[model samples]
Target: MLDFINRVLGRESGGSKEIAKERLRLVLVHDRASVSPQLLQALKTDLIQVISKYMDIDEKAMEVTLDSNERQVALVASIPVKSMKRATRTPAVSI
Candidate 1:
């Protein structure tokens, strides 16, 4: 088989196909888990709120992502702490 020969030859091949396959595999995994990108965002927001109560965290920089592979939904959350500034503007008074 050509695929077998390519493998044995140690030549770089199938890169595009391999990348596409990997993407499809992850998409399928997310689909099966009933986890959507929106859901993942909501989860991330909630998680940040809960965790912030105990420690300082950077909600904007936080990354909560979902990936699917082979009927499995992987929820990945990366929370980092950083300096944040509070808004200075106050509510406008009616003239």
Candidate 2:
């Protein structure tokens, strides 16, 4: 009720509590994904490399994370693309 009232009043409720709870949830999801910080960093680097092959992306703003709910885990990536590379074709060789 208070939360609803706060919403209607154009204010936010559960300020620090909500933030702490969300942080805890993220830690739990990351732990359940069995991904260490080093592993996650490596994955992020590899992803940037592979994605860079086809497009120009903002490395400083890229974000990658393992997210989860009660049912399953998900790998999420937010990459800001500056531009896409033009598609190129190679000549085919006859067997």
Backbone clash count for every predicted candidate, in the order shown: 3, 0
lDDT of 2: 0.88
- Cα deviation in Å at residue 44, candidate 1? 1.2
Of candidate 2, the 10-residue stretch with the lowest lDDT total is 84-93
Residue 39 in model 1: lDDT: 87
lDDT of 2 by residue, 1-95 (tens): 88999989989776898889999999999887778999989999999999888888999999999888789899999999999877553436698
> Which candidate leads the pack in TM-score?
2
lDDT of 1 by residue, 1-95 (tens): 88889989998777898889888876777676777788887888789878765567877788876665455566778888764435344547899
Question: What clash count does candidate 1 reach?
Answer: 3
Model 1, residue 18: what's the lDDT?
88
Give the top-scoring candidate (lDDT): 2
